[model samples]
Target chain A: EAGVTQFPSHSVIEKGQTVTLRCDPISGHDNLYWYRRVMGKEIKFLLHFVKESKQDESGMPNNRFLAERTGGTYSTLKVQPAELEDSGVYFCASSLTGRHSYEQYFGPGTRLTVT
Target chain B: AQSVTQPDIHITVSEGASLELRCNYSYGATPYLFWYVQSPGQGLQLLLKYFSGDTLVQGIKGFEAEFKRSQSSFNLRKPSVHWSDAAEYFCAVGLAYSGGGADGLTFGKGTHLIIQP
Candidate 1:
């Protein structure tokens, strides 16, 4: 069983540019989550997906950020008009849906640098 | 809302020495606690978790954490530090929803562990 996997381990873009980060969860996992960690700051939750539907998105930072899980297979986080403050590591995690949902497995985060 | 605090920003321990990293949390009910480690160029890895029953939980890579309800703390410990143990350790609290699926986690700033040779 492969752990969660993310695309484009590192991304560098200018402010106001759009960037999309992708995550492929483990096979048969129904729960997916997104989290971000700015430099010297704690990792903060962004949103969560149960299959193709959004479970919770209260943690989303701003309107410019959007997350989607299509076909209940993978997830994508898009940051439009990215700002300098958006430079950080974005992590995606996944787990089962039942009693073991708390046990989340993370992916190698995508380090985004917005200059 | 739940929150986590790691008092130590960084810690240095000699190889083979004992290690302890402090973590404090604030939540209403019995919190779900977790400890995760992130090595250089690696993703966050779950070390251990405490939901109920046992206060002391053992995890991978010879790591263990004790959950103390009185102190509102869950501290990670290792009997002997290894060079490979040098990494960033994060203490987190998972919000349990009554509905079903797991919610997002609240994480601490993380403690950077330095292993001296």
Candidate 2:
């Protein structure tokens, strides 16, 4: 089975511009998640989805960030009017839903640079 | 709120030497512990996990971690390190979900391992 894959491994955009990062999870996985790691900081959770419905979004930093999972297949994270502080590595992960399925497989991560 | 701490920012070990990376966690309830490694230009890979039961857990790549409830620590260890073992290691704690799946995780800043030959 393929692990999670992210698009545009690296992205460079000007401040105030919008950017969207996509993630294609492993086949048949129902749990999808987004996390971000700023330079010199720990990786932090952004949101989670279970079959197209958001399971938790408390970790979202602000209103400018948006995430969606359509048809329970893939996920997208959009940052509108991106700011310089939004520059970081965004990671997408997926896992199966079951009693013993506690492992979450991660993607290579998209490195976003906002100048 | 739950948090994880990797005390060592970086560690250097000679090849074939024993290795131990310290990790400390603070959580209200029982948490699901995990260790992950990321090589240059590679994604994070799960090394091992601790949900319950045995305190010592073996993982891929000949790595192991000991969970100590008394100390609130989960330290990763390797008896003999190799040159390829150089990478960044992360320690995380996941919230327990009622449905049995692990929820979002709280991660440490990570430790960079430098293996010397």
Q: Candidate 2's error at A60, in angstroms? A: 0.8
TM-score result, candidate 1:
0.98
For model 1, residues B1-117, the per-residue Cα lDDT tens digits are: 778999999999999999999999998887789999999999999999998998999999999999999999999999999999999999999977665757999999999999999
User: In model 2, how large is the Cα lDDT of residue A44?
Assistant: 96
Off-target runs (Cα >4 Å) in candidate 1 are none
Model 1 lDDT tens row, A48-100 = 99999998999999999989998999999999999999999999999998778
> Once superposed on the true structure, which residue ranges of model 2 sit more than 4 Å away at CA?
none
lDDT, model 1, position B89: 97
Q: Residues A39-61, candidate 2, lDDT per residue (tens digit)?
A: 99999999888879888899999
Instruction: For model 1, report DockQ.
Output: 0.87
Q: What's the lDDT for residue B5 in model 1? A: 94
Please list all clashing residue pairs in model 1, or write none if there are none.
none
How does residue A81 of candidate 2 score in lDDT? Answer: 89
